[model samples]
Target: MVRYAFSKIGMTSTFTTNGSAQGVTVLKMQPARVLRHETLENGKVVVVVEYDTGHKNKLVRGWVVDNPAEYQVGSPLKAPSLNAGQKLKITGFSKGRGFQDAMTRHGFGGGPASHGSRFHRSPGSVGMRAEPGRVMKGKKMPGQDGNVQVTLRNVQVAYWSTEESVMAIVGGVPGARGGIVFV
Candidate 1:
């Protein structure tokens, strides 16, 4: 088994034992906070950890239970465990650098909003003359943003007695609601 210690990045808590999970006991989590949890856009029970302090700005770290129980905000949970097939590390996603213009980012032309203002939303100049030479490698134009690798760990697991579900995760799980949560 690939043993992993339970831990929260910014939280002031530590756990020596790693959470374990197995079987179909993984299916009950709501999406919450993510850097790039888009890949898991299915109905996957994923637990996300918010890297940002604003309680909204965040990233997708990982999931909650093997068979996750229905989870909601302010729900109590216990620390979970992952064993063999249960432990899934989230991978693959473009990195986000933050903020991009529409024209260059999405590859579009400018439009005129006002009669006097001609340049409404254009990609503008990609490069200068030969002064800088060859449009400069990786010139700041615009394209793609918000997609990063985020991992959740040592999440406190809570019990859902009403549903007979044992895995309840504390804090926010990455991604939007119904997003897939990798082990």
Candidate 2:
């Protein structure tokens, strides 16, 4: 069974393990209070949890679990017990880069560079003539980039401190530091 918890991304640092230095991302688990519980038709249980974001606002998340009796409404959810080298999947939003160009966003190779071709960083030949008059849907155009949920799988735990509720996972974690992440 998978246990879910809400954590904030901490700093990125290196840790010595097995005589080798490995990059790790630190995460500080937030205290989540159980709001309610619901059971699905498929016998799956979902617990709604509320987390204090430290910004005067609350963040609510629903976690699916194998058993609902383990959680009680209006009480703090138990932190997941994790061990070193345990594989974990972390999900969070990536860093947002607002309003990017086609060359920067979609990695489009424009025409000419030196002799004033006027197509240095523009999206070229977007549509065809009368037959299909307009630009087709789902075209790779420049727009919002990042700020979307990203999940990283198979991230091994580099360190875990149950007392402090801090976890360090091997390798990089998506989103900005101090951002909310689910494990």
Candidate 3:
């Protein structure tokens, strides 16, 4: 299994996209404020900042920084350097679906409905017959679904409107509308 940790944090500025006449999309990113930061002994840095995503909660996030000392609290950040047609990665949380069954969650084929066999939509025999005496770990049982963080890589940057603080990307992005994504 891949072990993971939230080693750093940083927030992206609020941005909205607009498709241009030249078949390019533009992203308008707003200035963000630095909240707090940490400098690690290994030269890694993390910064927390506030973004303008208009979410119900304060749009605060953290990310690693090249130089943590360059930013102070309450300071507006400058626009990042991104060019048109640049390929970038967007990382964010996927939408959450609270609970699901085997058919929907694990993609199990249900028994035929016409035969009236009662086996439809069940997970079927999930446990072992007492040799190991316990259900195997990592079994494909239905439980909580989605809300996992994922990265969509190689997404092309259509264009950026630094003046307006928004940039448009060329493909589908993760998360709901107005959700923040890391590039």
Which candidate comes out best when scored by lDDT? 2
Please give each candidate's TM-score. 0.32, 0.90, 0.75
lDDT of 1 at 133: 56
> Per-residue alpha-carbon lDDT of model 2 for 1-183, expressed as tens digits?
434555556656675755777878888888878899878898888888888767688888787887778788998867787899899888889999999988899888878888978878888878979987999998888899989999999989988888888899888888887788888
Per-residue lDDT of model 1, residues 21-104, tens digit only = 411222243333332222245665554444222245444355533444343333433334433223244322334546778664
Better of 2 and 3 by TM-score: 2
Q: Rate the local accuracy (lDDT) of all candidates.
A: 0.42, 0.81, 0.64
Residue 32 of candidate 3: its Cα lDDT? 65
TM-score of 3: 0.75
Span of ten consecutive residues with least summed lDDT in model 3: 1-10
Residue-level lDDT tens digits of model 3 in 6-26: 111222332335633333223
For model 3, the stretches where C-alpha displacement exceeds 4 angstroms are 1-30
Best by TM-score: 2
The ten-residue window of minimal lDDT in model 2 covers 1-10
Model 2 lDDT at residue 126: 85
